[model samples]
Target: MTSHKRKTGRRRAVIGGLSALGITGAAVVTATLLAPAGAASAVAAWPQAKGSKPVPASIEFSGTYDGKLQRHYGTGALGSDGQDESQKPLFVLKDGAVLKNVVIGAPAADGVHCLGSCTLQNVWWENVGEDAATFKGTSASSVYAVHGGGAKSASDKVFQFNGAGKLVVNKFQVSDFGKLVRSCGNCKKQYPRTIVINDVDITAPGTSIVGVNANYGDTASLRNVRVHGDPKKKIKPCVRFTGNNTGKEPKEIGTGPDGTTCRYSAGDLSYD
Candidate 1:
């Protein structure tokens, strides 16, 4: 399908329900902020869906698709929230596509797939299936941006970086998940991955925030990260692994900021 470009000088559309409060970004800005030890921060409340829609097949979207805070769930062939690796996504975004103000419901399948550089703005996942979203842009310069939006109940991963490129996630919240972002561990072809996460809220009962392949020279930069519930700091901030092209499970090397692979300081993270 042909993908289009967003027109210049166009006013940004209001993310339904948040429009009245002047919250123009991907998430709802709440006055109650989580004071990150030494870092500045603001927490967000999850947006409520305006309605719900059932998707039977992957909807190929380009340019801009505003869901108006509607919940979209998989059905028929797209139905299934198992650990199957072959699950189809509810939406397939072409290069330069923008999917905004959307909420993915249960039986989410793969949730969303970005075939190339794309922006997922203010997109929430009520119950992530398989994974929330996968980045498949092959170009090193390609960028996958997830701005605003919160995800909960992700069994394994929230964002899967399978292809080469940079992933920027800002103003996001996640809870009850395994890993927030994971670089391709055993993809037949691997490339150095870059991840930037800022102003994010992470609730406990989670594993790690970001996992990267140190062997592949992947890097993850985190700032203004606030953790809730976990006082013992059981949730790892960053995890490093020696990834391989073979399908076998990758070997975990270590965890925490190495200043190289995991770029962050003690001030960059705080718990409450």
Candidate 2:
């Protein structure tokens, strides 16, 4: 692993999302942005785990694990050296639980992993490996129904709670997904009245994040988020908004025009 021990480290990295329509508790039509919360003072970066040699068989998803250990997970397309697919992402939910600033290649086939129900303030998303989906804290409940932002089998989610969970994201993003779709296409709750994104950034190939054939209506608060993070990686309409799409104006705060979405993967995303 590449550990950059910061002895009074000069600076740490930070990374830093949305959308609308429909009126169903389905998340059947919504979007999200993320912020940071619950992380330790020091964020640890793990080297990309090795990829499957000949591509593992398409694994099937069982369900959630007991309490919060984890049930099933499929490995994402990784590089030989075991790094994340800079282009794609890795399946981490079942394989393991990622916490605070832990770099990921791709999330699980269903969505991000949040084992136990917990409260979050902020989080982030980054694209440092070959190509993968970075995490940004959303909620503390059940798994979310993640969708293919642009790649294949990119639908999956992670949760940290039980019962009718609620996801509250502040900012979100997707970088270098031009040829694929345009951005992290879909992120919703499977059951009705589940999770919801507050702020967001849809940026894939189609010019937007949510697919034309989706209905993930989010009803959370939101703020300034982007599809890209730097000038060199500039796309279009870097930020987005996905207010209480459920028509209820969710519980949210603010962080407008962050202006730092152009740090080229060397920054920490703040949803906190």
State every prediction's TM-score relative to the real structure.
0.86, 0.29
How big is the positional error of residue 19 in model 1, measured in Å on the Cα after superposition?
A: 25
C-alpha RMSD values across all candidates: 9.1, 14.1
Q: What value does the lDDT take at residue 235 in candidate 2?
A: 31
lDDT by residue for model 2 (1-272), tens: 13445411211222211223111232222221112322222222223333322222332123332212122223444232223323233333432232232223333322233333322212222232222333333343333333212122222212222223343333333433432111122334322223333234434332322211112222222233343334443333222233333434223222222333211122332322
Model 1: per-residue Cα lDDT at residue 23: 32
TM-score of 2: 0.29
Candidate 1: give the clashing pairs.
none
Q: Rate the local accuracy (lDDT) of all candidates.
A: 0.85, 0.28
Q: For candidate 1, write residues 157-261 as lDDT tens digits.
A: 999999998898867899999999999899999999999887789998999999999999999999778999999999999999999999889999999999999
Name model 1 segments beyond 4 Å from true: 1-42
Q: Which predicted model would earn the best TM-score? A: 1
